[model samples]
Target: MCLRGSLHGPSRCGRNEGRDLSLDQPLLRIERLTKRFGGVLALNDVSFSVRKGDVVGLIGPNGSGKTTLFHCITGFLEPDPPSHVEVMGESIKGKGPDGIALMGIVRTFQELRVFRRLSVIENLLMSAQQYQEDKIVPRFLNTGVIRAHEARAKERARELLELLNLSSSAGKTAGSLSFGQRKLLSLASALMPDPQLILLDEPVAAVNPVLIDKIKEFILDMKCAGKTFLLIEHNMGVVLDICDRIVVLDHGERIAEGAPQVIRTDPRVIDAYFGT
Candidate 1:
């Protein structure tokens, strides 16, 4: 039996009452993850795990390899040999972006990836089509089976739009929506696949306080529905409120990791952020 709400707080599946997450294996794990860009060492032996149902926060200063870590994990960049990344206990070191995503991991970029010319719903439909079905014959033939699949995809898009409170903007051009709305749309698009673990890169960046709250609400709702997340956010307040455990990186190396409370008062964290 694992203790609840200790100084380190609960582990993965932390929010569940009286449940020990220790017996369960991690959903994602990395071992000695190292990345280098020519002469610059972007990441050196960084490691962490996001267990099932865990909302883990990844925080670091600028150029701390936080985004690079995300890229490596999602197959955007290859890590050096002997560096291992695993999803559900299987190695994903050499897998490409689509392959990793199909393996149940999806990520949202800090920079929005919405289609400017596409309608809000169209963008989501595109995401669904790309991942949900990849058969060339069904796509080009547009047979009854393919049409039914598309119908289901559109239905799922509507459901996601309603969930994210964007139902009214379904027909609007994605570029015409407010910046905050675009962010929400991007998040909805990422969810079109119903991915198991969603990696958010600064989900609340540049948004108003009201919109930030909405994003937070969406995350909490999904979490309650058994979705897991690994978030990279600079907003300390949001990180503290939403994450069960926080991991801090500085200069491309993991410097600290613990519950929010532990991270708040950590000496190394203060020094890293403040340079004191």
Candidate 2:
């Protein structure tokens, strides 16, 4: 269960009591990952590691299996045998989406996914509801515990709204916000759980230039507070600016992986993005 603490502070959950938090092991590791749908290979032997405080970019042409890789990591899809997705060195095989979330991995979609009818704060609260202890008898007998949990959840939601510059629109319905604001809300909702690894899907895809800068600032702020991110984005400028390292994918295979400078000048990466 998620413990009540500052959103950007060190993890306070009991889940990590005996786990390794050493520098030698990465926060997330993907090994020999492959995914196939009806003989159409989505990912082939893809492998990478994300350190505890690095913002890594996954860049590739459209249909390069970026989203598919996200799905497999977040438990929306399972990888083929011999493929391993590990969080803090533990295999997450057979763990569904909910289970994976509890292990501190959260993601946002390529398409906006907000509760259209719900207020902005309400939407954030809903994202946190899954973590509440929901035992029927305990709920009836221990209303105080539930109330405490709710209060903490709201506090975190408001902090996120303020961090994302959406505090003024807390009472507004999600659908009423501008497209970029909605995208900000999606990111805020994902942060509610205070996950260790955040997988962002095209975070600045269609926003105005001003909002794109705002989004970049938000991500950088979060990074300073010790958040680790693995984002898929086509905006090379944004990726190069924010990412410490990048993994270039082409046709479901990892073509290159290195620092931003190295990736920028890599012939294979250049060829993949702009064919010869």
Q: Which candidate number would show the highest TM-score if scored against the true structure?
A: 1
Locate the minimum summed-lDDT window of 10 residues in model 2. Answer: 10-19
For candidate 1, give the lDDT: 0.85
Give each prediction's root-mean-square deviation over alpha carbons. Answer: 5.9, 5.2
lDDT of 2 by residue, 1-276 (tens): 112353344322211213454546899999989999998999999998998767899999999999999999999998997799899988899988888888899999989999999999999999987644346677678999779878988988888888778999999999999999999999988888778889999999999999898888777767656678999998999998888789999999999998888899999998998566
Number of backbone collisions per candidate: 0, 0
Estimate, for each residue in 37-139, the C-alpha lDDT of model 1 and write its tens digit. Answer: 9999999999888887778999989999999999999999989977999999899967889889998899999889999999999999999877763687766
Task: Give candidate 2 regions above 4 Å deviation.
Answer: 1-23, 131-137, 274-276
